[model samples]
Target: MTNAADARQTKPDWSAVRLHVVTGKGGTGKTTVAGALALALAAGGERPGARRVLLVEVEGRQGLAQLFEAAPLPYEERRVAVTPDGGEVWALAIDAEQALLEYLDMFYKLGPAARVLRRFGAIDFATTIAPGIRDVLLTGKTCEVVRRRAESGQGPGHGHDRVFDYDAVVMDAPPTGRITRFLNVNSEVSGLARVGPIRNQADAVMRVLTSAQTAVHFVTLLEEMPVQETLDGFADLRAAGLPAGGVIVNQARPIVLPEDRLKKAAQPGGLDQAELEAGLAPVGLADPEVVTALAALAAEHAQRVLLEAEQREALAATEAPMYELPLLGDGVDRVGLDLLARELRRQGAA
Candidate 1:
């Protein structure tokens, strides 16, 4: 387990990857990290033209829109923007219905069968209310993107012969509780398709996921519940034979004040009396109670800093390669996203 300081020092090699799946406990800023990573890869000016990056969201959460400051993406892929090196960045919100249709059309050539499945409650009930099925479908769709084949003029090649056209795909996958099952759907499909097309497809997807070329990163905050969940999630992924890529601690606070300075501030009457009087005199705040209140605020900030340190330590114990993204005091927007992109590059995540 590397401490926060050490974790920050270590750099991630993003060049050796084709897919980066970002997930964590809900509200842990998983979406933010996913967006930042996509931007970072796109902004890799020295690399070979950003490598046709695709940012995918499965839950229709509009996170990409919020991060990019653009309109929410529809079911299909849309060219969002160009990267610094003129590489195209495409964004998509995965619609289970559409993915299902595409899946049927590509493999089964099942014309109108997709509509029949929806009308007969097979697709609707299975994807909407079903627990594990929705995860399987979403995960299947993402895997499909990673496995999509380019046109060969004659016909699609065999499973491994088809080369992935997209350089990288960033998936803002499901939350912590469901992500394990989401990534492990090959086992489920294997049971259903013993010797058929689905079986082959499942095997291909599993191959890609388990390969070193693909990575899954979990984004978390330095908080108690998220930390615990991240630990558990890591264990689940490893147990299921899925790759445990790395951990990212989001919204980390800067330890601006040293411990000795913080302790002195906590001490009663530790502040310089003359300096306090001089600083408060200009504001016409002569009351000792007001000065005490101001001092208390500083003390509170110091305590929060200590709490942040403790949280970082707890997160470090998970032993995964960790990255810390600073807390943005100002709200997230395009400018904030640009800052995050630069930070990711500096940390070698790009």
Candidate 2:
């Protein structure tokens, strides 16, 4: 909290949330954030023991599997990583065609017909011509898991003791540009089906989506374009009556120099070559070109810091609970993911 980007609010209380939908700009690392979030939620409960969280990929990119350094995931739920406290982070890449098939089997018992359609390329044609069908299928599958209950059914009488299949579900949803349409697809379907099974399914998904138990968090970088998209995405969520969750700033460069020093170095002609050479002289050797190079590097860092500060200010105006993730020097691997998960826990995002 000492140096967080937004200080207007405290960390969100995620205890009530069961579905965490993460989306962002194309290059904002939304998938990586979703992966880390699954780990944090699984490991950071109040009385955590054997907690299982589902990390679902709707884009079919197997981004989660790659982040965990595993083979490409199937449509089935596969346990990918074990949390520090022995909890599990299971992953599943939700394929649209497969989801459609499952939907037919679950509610309509049309497995045979669906398979036949797939073989005839009807499923592909339908999904392509009506993309909303694909999104509906994917979101439906996600909600199914969010609402799944434990088979034991031996919890408290008031439902406080009831166990759930997963502690939470984190989705690597589509980019912000298309998230509104993707999430709101069910409502569109309602227009076509008034009171049939499809209508019921759409209504059910909407109920879960617009409820307090679901929150859509946005991932962004401290830059102009991504920040603008984040703002627009939040506005869309509000207009569509969707719940807005936290604002996670990913890969934010650390603020090395203090405020006054950074401002001084950022000013025009503030960095002097002679002064840089004098500072570098203490090292074994220093040359004029080296001084020039060092001065340019310091100037660039200073300017970047100043611009990033401006972007942070813009985001702070949203008044959303914010969290920052540092840029991994070695890139996001299994080790890097563990580091990020620990950071989320320390920041109370879990």
**The best candidate in terms of lDDT:** 2
- 86-111: candidate 1 lDDT, tens digit per residue: 66567889887777777788888987
lDDT scores in order = 0.74, 0.83
Q: In model 2, which runs have C-alpha deviations exceeding 4 angstroms? A: 5-12, 153-162
lDDT value, candidate 2, whole model: 0.83
Q: Which ten residues in a row have the lowest lDDT in candidate 2?
A: 153-162
Residue 9 CA displacement from its true place in model 2, Å = 8.6
lDDT of 2 by residue, 1-350 (tens): 13563343335457789999999999999999999999888885665556788999998787888889899999888889987787788888999899888888888899788899899998889789877678788998999988988665442112233377787899999999989889996666755667887777877898999998899999999899999999999999889998988889999887776777677778998676676678778893479887777777777888998898788788877777788999999899888888888777777677
